[model samples]
Each structure stands twice: as C-alpha cells, then as structure tokens.
Target: MKTAASSVISDNDNTPAQSIPRSPRLLETLLANLDGVVYRCRDDAQWTVEFVSEGCLQLTGYLPEELLLNQRISFLELIHPDDRQMVRAHVDDCVRLRRRFDVEYRIVHVEGAIRWVWGRGVGIYNADGEVEALEGFMQDVTERKEAAQALQEAERRYRSIFENAIEGVFQTTPDGTYIAVNPALARIYGYRSPEDLIVSLRDIRHQLYVEPERRSEFMRLMEEHGSVSNFESRVYRRDGDIIWISENARAVYGDAGTLVFYEGTVEAITERKLYEAEMRHQATHDALTGLPNRNMLHDHLQRAIQSARQKGGLTAVAFVDLDQFKYINDSLGHQVGDELLKTVAQRLMSCVRDSDMVARQGGDEFVLVLQNQTEGDVGIAEVMQRILAAVSRPWQAGDREFHITSSIGVSRYPTDGKDVETLLKNADSAMYKAKEQGRNNFQFFAPWMDTQVSNRLEMLISLRRALDQQEFKLFYQPKLSLKDGRIIGAEALIRWESPEQGMVAPDRFIPFAEEAGLIVPIGEWVLRTACRQNKAWQDAGLPPIPVAVNLSPRQMNQALPEFVANVLADSGLSASWLELEITENVVMKDAEKTVATLNTLKRLGLQISVDDFGTGYSSLSYLRRFPVDALKIDKSFVRDIARDADSAAIVKAVISLAHILNLRVIAEGVEDEEQHAFLRENGCDEVQGYYFGKPMTVDDFTDRLRKEAVQAAP
Candidate 1:
C-alpha cells in the first residue's frame, strides 16, 4: 500500500516521518489552492513536464494529465510559437549559471486566445551539481501590461501638444523664475530654444517684463483670485524691443495645498495694442491741422480747471477768430482758405508754451488753454500778444502774399467762468466785443460782458417773438427845408413796444437784429409800412410828401430793387413818394455792387440817401461814383459841432462836398437852435432833429401835414 508518492515523502523526512506526523495530502492541498500553475519539468529541449499542479487547467486551459510527463502536450508547446526560442535560451542560461530566471512572455490557451504570462524558475539540482529539472510558477498578467502601454501612449500625446502649440506655454516658480517652458514659449520670447530661455532668463520679473511691477501685480492677482484671465502687460524681448502680451494662468499647488508654481499660456498682442493707440489719437486730434479738436479740448479744459483749483494757479482760455477769413474764403476760394487755416494753426501752436494746449474749435476759430500760470493776466496777455504778432506775420497762400489779422478773447478760470461751457461761452462773447472794437485786438472777459451777453440772448429771443406778435410800431420824424423852414419830408423810425418791457429803445435791439440776421425782415416791414402810411396820408387829402425808410447792411442785396418795387405796388404808392436811406458803410462795403444796386433802385424812381455820412471810410472817388441824391450828416458830428472844431470842420466839408457833387446835404441831430443856425448858415439843404420835432405816430404826422395844407390853401 505504500506507493511511490509515500516513499518520496518518507525518504526526504529521515527521522521526522513519525515525529513531524507528515501527511502526503498536505503537499497536494498547497499546490491545488494556488491561482497559478506550479510545474517541474526535465531540462530537455521539449521541457517535458514531470509534474504539473491542478492550476494548469485554469492557467493554460489544459488538465494536469494532458500536460504532465508529455501525456498529451508538453508545457513548451503551450507557450506562444513566437516566444519559444527566447524562453528556451533564457531558461537554459539561468540553469547553466545556477540562478533564478524571471521572464514575461505570451502564451496561447487551448481555446486559441493569446494571453500575457510571467514565469519565475529555479533549477532542482542533485548532490553532484548535475542539472535535473526546472521548477517554476507562471501567472496571468495581461490587464496590467495593457494598462501600462496605454499610459505610455497618453504621455506621448501630451508631450507632442506641448512642443508644437502656437501659444506660449510655461510653468514658472512662485518667485518669478521659469521652471519649464515649451518650444513655443522660447520662440515667443525671442530665444533659440527652450533650453536657451531657461539658461538666459533667470529672473522673469526683471528680465522679461518692461515694467517690473507687472510681475508683482500678477502674483497679487494669483493669490487673491487663484487664477487670472487676460492679464495684459508690456514686456521686452531678447532683442530689446517692447511688445504687448496677454496671459491666462493659474497657481499650480502641490498636494499639500501650497503653491508650487504657475502654469500659463501667453499670446502676443503688440499689433492690437498699437492699433488701439493709433485709433485713440485719431479720434482726439484734428485731421487737417493736427491739433486737438473740440472733443479733446473739452477734456483738457476740464483737467486744467481741476488742476488750477487744486494747485492755486490761474488758467486762461483764449478764443481766437480770424477777422477776414470769411471775406477771403468767399473771394479767393476754399482751398486757399484751408491753407490759411493750416498756417494759422502752426502759428498758434508756436505762440504758446509746451505746457499749454491749442485746439481747433472749428471754422476759423481756435482755442488756447494756458495752464498753471503764476503771473496771472500778465502772462496770459504776453502769450496773446505773441499770438497776435505771429498771426499777423504775412504767409503765402497759393503763391499770393496776404496779410491777415486775428481777434482774440480770453477768459480766466475761477474768475470769468468756473466750468468748461461757461468759460468757452464767455470767451466767445469777448471775441465779438473785440470785433466791435475794430478787430485785430484781444479782450479779456469782464463780468459786465457776461451780463451784456445774457441780455443780448434774452433780447434776441424776445425779438423773434416780437416780429411774430406785431410788437413793432413806426414813428415819423419830419425833415424841414432849411431855406424855407418848411416840413418837406419825414423819416420813418422803428420802435419796439414790448409787452414784457415797455418801449425798448432801437439802440438796444437793432444791433442784435443786424447780427442775428433778423434785420432784413424788420427792414422790409419798415419799408412797406412807411409806404402804406404815406399813401394813406395822401388819400386823406393831405399834402403829398416823401417818407424816408432806413435800410440795414444785410438788406442791401441785389434783389432789393425788386423788393422795393413790390412794396410800392402792394401799397399803391408811387416810388417817388418813398425814399430809401442806407448807412455810409453799407454803401461802401462793395462799391461796384452797391452802385449797381442803387442805380437799379433809382431807376424805379426812388431817391437814395447815404445816412451816417461822416462815420465810414468813403473816399471821394467812390462817393462820386455812387448814384445817391442826398447825404445825411452823422449825429456824432452834429452833436459836437460847437465844442469840437474837428466836428465843425467835418460837417462843413461834407456840406461843401455834397453841393459840389450836386447832392443834397442834410444835417441830423440838430438839437439846439444854435446847431440849426450853424447848419442853415453852412448852406445845408435840409435839417431834422429834436428842434424840428421828435419822432411821432403816423396820426400825429398826418394831422400836422393837414394843418400845413390848410395854411397853404389860405
């Protein structure tokens, strides 16, 4: 009953077979419970199996009887065909060296599926050191091998993207040192390679960014927000050129939640930043003159006002207007006008300090903002005088030399105005006053000027309403024949009877009408009303007399003759009974055109008289060429005739000149009997003043005319 298995165990135990109480079943149970195959094979070419454990069925899909002792198939045949020679060589070398052999290879199952397996073996040797058999353990390890190969593939893909990305990728230490940089990051920073960037750029804060504080700001944002998107900065390249860049980055923390480094992607934005700057410049600067425009001027003025308030200094805003620019543009051409404006712009810029700003307020107007002036008006005045001299210096325009002048008006901050709009508006008002002061000068804004401006604006608004509401009336002042002391004619004067303010003087609103272009309509109303009233008097069986109506400069257009004729026709009055009076300046503004228009009116049988005769620049030659029948002495000369010898001489000379030209001369504003006697003694053709009669209503004049007619009839 003692079989071979028992004998083998008993021989190995020596004296311990009874003492150890060894069981033959203990060896079988240990081998049967293993998850892998345990085998002993002869060290032959076939690796013929001598014993195979029960795990052989699950590991190789073969029963132990089928593999053991080459009963069905040898263990060597169970290995994949491709791995047989390598396995044999490896095991044979280990056996010859008397060392353990460990290997991993492929094996084929009985079902024809390939699986990965690991084998570890040691040689079972005899006392004589002769190779007997190989004993090894083999296991299935296919899942672990496949998992490791997949991880290798993923790593390869990540490395490819990192190397070839367009945007720069980097990992930087928390202290602003580069830990890792891709090839793209190196090229973006103007380096030869990633290794070159790492070696050369040690301090990102000092060596990379143009402004070193940008790096600190970056670190601050990272600490506060844990990430940053679109972090823009100006940085320098290896070639010492500056460029703009934007970064998207986050703090890379270690497993312990402490920040280790920052990982980021950077994009170059130099071109975009440059384009934005250019666009901003274009928006704030003038296209033709290259000066700051109105928009920029407002912004700069606001800042200047604020600075002056804070620093305790004065700021001046000068409004400049080219005096003769309109005439030049109308006569020469807009091309020459544009060239002149450019020249003036340059001259203005040269007149101010670098700290000041000159801006174009559009259309022959420029504004200068002088900042931080300790010398106050004296410094502002000096700069204005320099501007005046520079602008007056003659410059060429299309090969023609011309001399032009500018009128400047200045307003100081915290005095004339405290805000931008108030300052500019006050300056404009002062500019008009400069023009009124005969142009080619500068005026500082006064508090009274602001009151005048406010009053003028209110008057203009009221004037517009007055015309629509028929708040106007005509008063007639009789003109006497000095030779006979008889009422020969009457002058129709306009009066405004306002509901809000009673009896506004003509001096208060007439100038406004002229400037605001409302005079033409008001002048036409006077002409038509005078004509109709004169005709009504004639119809009332009174003596027929001519009524004089004053014409404004704006009303002296070429169509005036037709307009007068239409009025004459509409009122059913003869043109001979209506006289048109124009100021001396109006007639002399454009001599040739004025002569033509006067001739046309004279042909319609209306008499023309030059009013305010001594106040304008009219030469003898132009006066002779004018087709006027009478000249009215200006009130300025008549008022001072007795006191001022110059006034007396001017009046007398005008009388003699008018007579020489065969034109009637009339003296107005003959207030006293002495002035009347002087005018009559000087051979003046007519006289009209307060001494004769003040301006009266139409009914009052008509009654006087009736009384004169009755006296003549008797």
Candidate 2:
C-alpha cells in the first residue's frame, strides 16, 4: 500500500511513481475543496512550487497549472512587494525549528488587486530527517486587517486630546486618590510633573484645598446633583501658594449606576478676583491718601446718625480744616503738602476711638464721626484737643522741620440738625469761624453763623462770573533807580472792577480764585497781557525797560518757565525785557526743584528776583544758591527803618548782603524822603513805592512814561 502523504499528488501522468503514494483520490479531493491552497516547493531561492491544489484559483485568482512547477509564475511572485521578506523569514525559521510556519501577509492577485492573506507551511523531510521541499496554505484576511488599523487610529486621537488640553483635565477616584492627570493639571497645582502630583497629593480634601470645607462642599454638591458647574474655591498649590480656581465637574458612574470616579476641568481665576478687589477699593477710598472718600463718608455719617438715634446717644460731626495749609502749600510745594496731609490723616485716626471714623472730605479737609458720645461736647472737646496737639507736632521733609495745625468745628446731633446735609453745613460754617478766630482752635456750631457761610458762598459764585464778564484790569507802578532817580522798570499788579461789587482789591477775590483753582488761567492771562503791553510800549518808540510781574505761589511751578517763554514769543517781545518776581518763601520751598526751574528761566535771558524778602523763613545757605538777579525789600522793614534800630539794621544788612552776592537790592514802600535817603545811603540799587510813583492805570502809566521820555531827551 502507498503512503497517505503521496496520495495528495494529482492524477496527471507526468510524475514518477516513487514520488506518489496510494489513496490519491481522497487526498486530492480534500486539498481541492478546502478554503486555501496547499503547495509543495523545493527549498530553493524562488520557493518554487512543484505541486499546487485547485484552491489556488480562489486564494490568488490563479489556477494551479499557472503557478505550479514555475510554469507561468513562481509562488514567491504572488507575495506582495512589501511582505515578501517577512514571509520568507517566517518560512525559514519554521524550517530550522522543524515545525510548521504560520503568518499573515499581503499578496498580489491575478487581477492586480492587493489582498491580505494567511499562510501556513512546513518543510518536508525524508527518513534521514533532511529537508526535501516546502508546503503551505494561504487564504484572504483583508477585512480583519482593516478593522484592526481603524481601532489603533481611534486610540491615538484619544491619547492626543488627553495630553494636550489647555484646561487642566483630571480623573480621580471616589476615595480621593488621583487616577489620571494631564500636564496642564500638573502646572495648575505648581507640580514638577503629573506623576509627582498624582503620587504626592493623596488627600484631596486636606492637601489640595486651602480650606478643607471647600472639598467637602464640592462632594456634597456632587452627591445631591451629580455635578458641579462653576464651583469656585481657594486652593493650595504644591508649593503652598494660594490661588482661586473655578471647576466644572461631574460624577462618573459605571453601567450598573455605581459611582466610579470624578472627572473635571479646572481654570485659574486669581487675576480676575484681584481686579475686582482693586476696583472696589478704588470706588470707595481716596486715591491720594487711601482714606475713606466723600461717598463712603456720607454713608458712614448716616449710619452713625441712625445708630445714635436708636440708642438715644449723642453724635458729634466734626469738620476739620488744616490751618495755614494753603500758605504752606504755596510757600513750600505740593509734594510737601501731600505728605503733610497724609501725616495729618494718620494723626487724626490715632486721636479717635475704634467706634469713630475719620474721612477725607476733599483737599485739606476731613470729617470725623464720633458715635455714642453721651458726654456731649466735653468728650468731643478732648478729642479735638488731642488732634490739635498731634497735628502741631513738627515733621521733617528733606531735612527741613515743619509744623501744621488744624481748626475743627463740632456739631452735635439734635442740636445742629437731624439730617446729614444740615449737620455738614453747620460743621462747615463753624469751621470757617474757627479759621476766622486765628485758626489752631475748635469752635462749636452756633445758629447765628449762617450769615458768614452765606456770604462765602455768594462770593465764590460771583467770582466765577467775574472772569467771564471781563471785570479784571492791570495796574503798573514805576520802579526808580536810586542813583539816577529815573524810572527803570514797572511792576504789573492785578485789580478787579466787579459789576456787583465796585473796585475789589486783589486780596478780596484772589483767595477765592486760588481756592477754586482758577488762578492758573488768570495768572496766564496776566503774564500774556503784561508781555504784550511791554512790547506795545517799545514799539511806540518808548524806553525799553524790564517789566516786572509778581508770580503767585500757585503759579511758581515747573510749567511756568515754558509758559513764560511761549508768552514772550507770542507777544514778539524780547525775554531780556521781562522780570519775574517770585516771593522769597516760594523760592525756598523745594530748593532743588526751584533751582532747576530758576535756571531754565535764566536760560531764557529773563530776570529772576526774590520779592518780599525777610518776611518768610529764608535760609542763608539756600539764598546764596538761588539763580536770582535782584532782591526786593518788603515794606515791613522799610516802614520803620528810620525809627526802629532793628529795622534799620535789617535793611542795611540785606542791602550789603545782596551787593556781596552780586544781586541788586530794591526797597519797596518808601513813603518819605528820610526812608528814601536811608535806603539810598545803605546801597539800595532801586526803589518802588508811593515816594517814587503809585500804582496807576495803563493810560496813566503810559502818560507818565511819555513825560519821562521827554525829560530825558535833553
């Protein structure tokens, strides 16, 4: 009988009988009907096919006669270009191990279509166990291969989203352990890496949240609602830094409705929180001194009134005005003025109890509300005295010591009025009275003081209309050279001819102007008018002398130098023909800045002079440093120089000092020959007063100049 392995050969009469076996019909039927090809080939380079089954037509769309025996194409030619090496290596490995080979790869079909195929093969051996030929089966598996590739792509997309999200994404177990966290989550918690944060932060309730209650609250919300939207909390980072966070999360559950874990996104909101806080503070507090402003003060005052009324207690509303604050600001500087106000605010706060409040009512003004002052004015009086003493204590600004005082006006509830407006008005009126009484004192509100307040209100209103109505004029007074007894220059002074109030002097309305902040514009008008008039006189072929203009303390600022230069250019006048006279105290204020400003003016070729000398606290050291060309003696010393030895000594010393410093000295307010002779003998370079010429209108001054020009023609 023939072996079964030999019976698999075809019935064709080409093969030798030794290569065949018995039972050929059954074996051939099985190989032909099976779903794949069964092949036999020599163990050679081409993996040549020697015997092929009928199934070759179904697997590769080629008949057995076409592929067997290398008739038309070798079996290796059917393998795909990309999978040929892998198929050959698998067959070789199986042959070396003496085992069957199994692999899945691609093959080119007869119709030129590429198809995925499964292959199996084994090396044939003789009795001596030496290889003879190879055999294998292959079948189509294209659908299964495509399905696997699609699955891999989906997984890759999911992983990318999890890794690169901007909002911190997290998954945590119900027991408060982190299951997964993205890189963004690591950064939000100030961690070096997501692994570090997940491994280290075990107790989310106590470790992650700044307040443990926040985590508890989050859990409670999720338990009831199964989700939390826009839940806000303060959280601690890995470095122990606190920040605000907003979270939107939901409870994740299994298919059986059992709690699985929590998943969420987190966003940082610390910057938004801080911005809101800053806006709230700016809305209710003074920006300059960081004190409660007018809006907050009114609210507090009303609350105090309501509480005092409920308890049947007394409430005192004290209005505080800084004494000589304007003088200090004008003579010193605004920087110093602001420092003084801040210092005064702190002192006022110290003088009051915790139940009391001190609020800024605007510049140089403060309001205090003392609630439950059952002892009435007596307790209020004590507080006022304390504030007075506190403010009067000397403070230093840039090595210069200075003192300030306050005038307080107190109005009691039920005595002044029940409402906020009436109480504030009464306190303000009494404050003015305190100022009138030489300041540095306190006064209680009286009913009869209404007229003074009314008068002040009326004056402020009328002054506003005065500038628009053109009720202002300038007067010029001649300055005479003491040596030549001739008119050298003229001082320009401002006067108001009001329609309602006739002939108002500067002293009356200038204070109102300064307080209302209208002086800057008014001062500019004065400067332009003086420069234009001086130019007009020179154009008329009159003597060209320097026209001196007094600069108010408010006008003596850094902007003044540029403004003066512009006015000279616009008026077509030479800067050399203008003299700017600033007060001694104004120059002494902020010595460094004043020096810079004075140098700028000097560069414009205009003359700079110190007016009203000896009336203010003038330091000799600073005086030598000023870029001034002239000094004007104040009338106080000039009035009594002949009678008073001290006044004579002061005048002589000033004149001598000015000459030594290369500054020309002019004595003001010389009313008689004796005062004039005294100033001249003491080396006064110039004189200006009634003795020389009084302040006259433009027309009068022009006439005087013309006559002097005529007299000098000889």
Listed in order, each prediction's TM-score against the native is 0.52, 0.53
Summing lDDT over every window of 10 consecutive residues in candidate 1, give the lowest-scoring window: 275-284
Top-lDDT structure, candidate number: 1
Put down candidate 1 lDDT per residue, 1-714, tens digits, no spaces.
556766677878776555543356767888899888899999888899998899888888889999878888888898899999999889999999999999999999989998889999999999999989999999889888888778988888988899989999999898877888899888888999999998999999999999999999998999999999999999988999888999999998899989888998999999768744643454466545768877789889999999888987899999999988989999997557867988999999898889999999877999999998889899888898999999999878667788999999999999989999999988998888788889999999987765566778898999999999999999999999998888999999999999989998898799899889999999988998999999999898888889999999899889999999999999999989988999866876788999999999999998999998755546567889889999999875787676656568667878987998999998898888878878888999999999989999888887888888888785
lDDT of each: 0.88, 0.86
Worst 10 residues of 2 by lDDT: 3-12
Query: Each model's number of backbone clashes?
Result: 0, 0
lDDT of 2 by residue, 270-294 (tens): 9767744554454466545667877
Question: Which residue segments of model 1 deviate by more than 4 Å?
Answer: 1-33, 37-99, 106-115, 122-135, 172-177, 215-231, 247-263, 287-289, 321-343, 362-364, 392-407, 432-441, 446-714
Deviation of model 1 at 711, angstroms: 88
